[model samples]
Target: MLLKLNPEHLLLIRTHAASTYPEECCGIILGYLANESKTVVEVIPTENAWSGETLEDNKRRRYAIAPEIMLKIQKEARDRSLHIIGIYHSHPDNPAIPSESDRIQAWQEYSYIIVSVPNGKAGELKSWHLDGDRQFQEEEIEIA
Candidate 1:
């Protein structure tokens, strides 16, 4: 699978990552899906709700999206004739790679865009797709 996005959209993710330093920020990618591909057309930022949870749920290390939020976004996407093709989240001081928790929590067939922000500076941004084998495969990000 391939993830295509505009350069400005990438910038938006980076900005969100920077603005939410020390804690992970997350958002949605609304787009159109073609054969074997998803093109990001909009970035919808969301609040990181896990930060306020118990100590076990470290804001800097983990992220959680309320099921209702996902459902609402799905409805909104469908209403706009678009799809929630993927989700993007930041990893403060970590690599732009999926953590074990991410892999386990990820929904199959959705693109997971991870951004690395080291020392409050945005570093790398990459997208992955969970396959039938229950593994994440890095997808090509065609910035058009």
Candidate 2:
């Protein structure tokens, strides 16, 4: 599948990644699916709501959208005739690859975008989708 996004949307995600360096940045992508492509219409950045017991388990390695925030976004998307086509997140100082935890929590219908931020600089961006076996398959990213 293909993931299409405007350059402005790309910039917004990159900027958010850089701003939240050392901690992963996360957001929702609102859009529509047509044929075999997903076209992004809105990019909504959110706080990494992950809270762990120790400082070691922090945003640096994890991220989450609060249930309330997700519900609100879902309602807004429905009103605007858009679906949550995908989700995007940053991997600080790491490659743009999904971790095991990512797979465990992902839904089959949404594309997953990961941006690599090495030393506060946003680098490669990649898209993925879960296969029937629940394994991640890389998707093509088209910037317009």
Candidate 3:
């Protein structure tokens, strides 16, 4: 399914992701109500544990979605009749591309939005989808 992102929402993701640079930032993907296209409504930034100042291996730096936050997001989505479309995170010094570890850990049914923050600047935003066989495919994101 194609996800349409509002410009404001895009900015929120970019800004927050960049602000937490050198460490990972995470958030929930929320959908809109009463829209014909049913695009993403908002990008909600949540508290995340920083993986320290050192650039560790991918396995070591992977961000874990806190269970309480996950439950909260799920409840919000259900209340609004929206789905938990995706999860987003930042890659402090790397490109907005998924690492092998990311590929292995991503949920096949949800979109994974990666923000690449290189040198404290918002570098790129990329989305991915896992096919039936669990192979990753890059998806296009348009900011409206």
Write down the RMSD of all candidates, one decimal each: 1.5, 0.9, 3.4
If both were scored by lDDT, which would come out higher, candidate 1 or candidate 2?
2
lDDT of 3 by residue, 9-128 (tens): 878888988887666788888775333233687788986744445556432356767788889889988998888878888888788888887789788767788888888887788888
Superposed model 2: Cα runs more than 4 Å off: none
Clashing pairs in 3: none
- What digit string (tens of lDDT, one per residue) describes model 1 on residues 1-144? 888898899999999999999999999889999998898889988888775566657888888777789899999889999999888999999899999889998988689999999999999999998888999989999988
Clashes of each: 0, 0, 0
lDDT rank, highest first? 2, 1, 3
The candidate, 2 or 3, that scores higher on TM-score is 2
Off by over 4 Å in 1: 51-56
Give me the candidate number with maximum TM-score: 2
Model 2 earns a TM-score of 0.97
lDDT winner between candidates 1 and 3: 1
What is the TM-score ranking, best to worst?
A: 2, 1, 3
